[model samples]
Target: MGREIYFGQQELTLKLTGITRFFAIRRKVTMPYSTIKEVLVSDFEAPKWMIRAPGTSIAPLNIYEGSFNYGDEWYFLSFERKEPVVIITLEGHSKYRYVVFAMDNPTKTAAEIRRHLHEVV
Candidate 1:
């Protein structure tokens, strides 16, 4: 019941409850491990040109939620810091081509996801 990514038995679940979802501008997302194609973690400073529509985007505060078009692909971004974030590339009939989420420990989160992905493969 804490604010952490839950790697479920069949899918990856990100919990977004209470005020965190509104301020953070994100909803709880669950994606099957089978859909994951790649996972990358890196330091990300919010870009000035990220247009948020139909989705939430508060660039000045470094808070982005919802979906944005980038590189001709739609990405789901949920974060509020200029620190390490995990970018997950997904395939198949998923809602987004990529998903970006900030983690307290991006490196650890990425590793956990990678481990689960490998097990599924």
Candidate 2:
């Protein structure tokens, strides 16, 4: 039941499977790209309460990080989209040792990331 989600010029749609977490943002609504960009620019580091993951990690669906170090926290998965790279953890661990780090590409600079994010589809 796994199907691909597509994002092109002016279209966005989803084909549901048995499972899927918060990943791509549908273009159906006008999204605040600026806020996303801000988050992506500075939040992919390890937090202040880093700890071992409770279970084995899973690979991401795209060019993304499965884990990141913020300061003292650990994020399980990071979803790379056009605007930001969203971090993910277990459902109840949104704080402390488990949290998401919204980020842009690490290899690329912020300006480069913004350029990629605003590409004409």
RMSD of each: 2.6, 10.4
Please, what are the lDDT tens digits per residue for candidate 2 over residues 1-121?
1223334444222232222222311111122232232323434433334333432223342323234445665444333333443322232333323323233243243454345447732
lDDT of each: 0.74, 0.33
Q: What is the lDDT of candidate 1?
A: 0.74
Q: Residue 86's C-alpha lDDT in candidate 2?
A: 34
Off by over 4 Å in 1: 1-3, 24-26, 45-51
- Residue 118's lDDT within candidate 2 is 74
Give the TM-score comparing model 1 with the true structure, all chains together.
0.80
lDDT of 1 by residue, 25-78 (tens): 566777888888889998666556655644667677776766687655667777
In model 2, what is the error at residue 89, expressed in angstroms?
13
Top-scoring candidate (TM-score):
1
Mark the regions of model 2 whose C-alpha exceeds 4 Å error after superposition. 1-40, 43-45, 54-108
